[model samples]
Target: MHELSLMGDVLALVKRDAEARGFAEITRVRLLVGDLSNALPDALEMAFDMYKAEGTAMLASEAQLALELRQARATCVLCGLDYVPERSAAAAMCPVCRFPGGRITEGEEFKVLSYEGR
Candidate 1:
């Protein structure tokens, strides 16, 4: 899965920053994963575990991964209605006015929120 490479990139970035700050090992990582981010949380976790199992030097033996799921949200301009959108839908649609052009307000995030190292 692409999550393997994605997690690799994240860990590399964290390792670089943490080492620059004089940290010896990464203890935790927190990610904000939106529903529409196209990155699977389970796959990410598996990738993290694989890295940990490999005994990566920058990762602590008990390193933890925390994924904060963000729900997809959209707002209809025609009806002024805000609602959650289906993750697999091609476009955001408003339930109230049945508008097919609802503007997405959130849930496209796929980033590292924070990392802990020491």
Candidate 2:
């Protein structure tokens, strides 16, 4: 699965950071995943448990998952005005100018915003 590969990258990053900071063991890892980011937390946890066996850092680490919400930015085609929408997961049209299909501007990001370890 893609989550397995993603976990591998996460583990590598944690290890790299731990080694650089001289941390003997990682007790916890807090990750902020955006709502629009296509990632499965359960899969990540399972993969981390499977991959961190016998590892110095993650063997005792606890993976914490936090959700971050992002309002989708859309532009009204009729009025040429950009605004953030209220809801996600819908092809919401512009209410003010009645644009049939507003252009999306944001809500597509996947990255590790913050990590806590040691």
Candidate 1 segments whose C-alpha is farther than 4 A from its true place: none
Residue 61 accuracy (lDDT) in model 1 = 91
Q: What digit string (tens of lDDT, one per residue) describes model 1 on residues 22-42?
A: 998999999999988889999
For residues 50-114, what per-residue lDDT tens digits would candidate 2 score against the true structure? 77664644545454544455545778877988877656436647878766678877765555665
Could you tell me the lDDT of residue 110 within candidate 1? 92
- Candidate 2 residue 56 Cα shift, in angstroms, is 6.5
Per-candidate count of clashing residue pairs (backbone under 3 Å): 0, 0
TM-score of 1: 0.94
Q: What TM-score does each of the candidates earn? A: 0.94, 0.61
Q: Candidate 2: give the clashing pairs.
A: none
lDDT of each: 0.90, 0.65
C-alpha positional error of residue 61 in candidate 1 after TM-score superposition, expressed in Å: 0.7
